[model samples]
Target: MGVTGIGGLFFRADDPEALKAWYAQYLGVAPDGWTPWEQQAGPTIFEPFARSSDYFPAERQHMINFRVTGLDAMLERFRTAGIEVVTKAEWDSPEIGRFARIHDPEGNPIELWEPA
Candidate 1:
């Protein structure tokens, strides 16, 4: 027996409260306080990025990808909320899925994925 699944993700934020609020407001994460969010299971990718990879910003140590249902709807929501959503044609395919990128208020890279 090995690891079951990801327990949680911990990171440092300049203003934890404000960051938490941003995540709650936009991503629908931690909407009901510090309780656990029940996620609908599917595919999860756990790949490490090369140091020289340009997939994400150079300054950030890591980028997180979250599975989503509706890519277009989410993109529209992000646009309506005044958040910049970055998408590229090369990042998507019929076999894998679609992806969009957005940064948190504190400049953390967040990737949204919608599986094909």
Candidate 2:
């Protein structure tokens, strides 16, 4: 059979332990060597942007999109936790979804999407 789904996402971090802990504490993502986070089943987008695509930042090589529920609550939580979240009215639609952006301590772009 072909690839089933994303098996893992591995990347380098300036302070790996701190980064791992940050993900675990804020996003509920399991840290390295712990039980892999069990993401709820849903749609996954796998589009390759053009070199000059301005959808996300140009400095970063990749942007990860994580589907979520309760978009408003999550945004509020992030704000209360001192994590800046960016949202645009134009990015949401009845057909697509709502989106918000945040960066990790290392400045990696993360997109949180809530399906419409």
Q: lDDT scores for all predictions?
A: 0.89, 0.89
* Worst 10 contiguous positions by lDDT, candidate 1: 30-39
| Model 1 agreement with the true structure over 3-78: per-residue lDDT tens digits | 8788788899999999989998888887775699888878777888898999899899989899988889989999
What lDDT, from 0 to 1, does candidate 1 have?
Answer: 0.89
Q: Return the TM-score for each candidate structure.
A: 0.94, 0.93
| Model 2 accuracy (lDDT, Cα) | 0.89
Model 2 quality (TM-score): 0.93
Question: Candidate 1: how large is its RMSD?
Answer: 1.1
Off by over 4 Å in 1: none
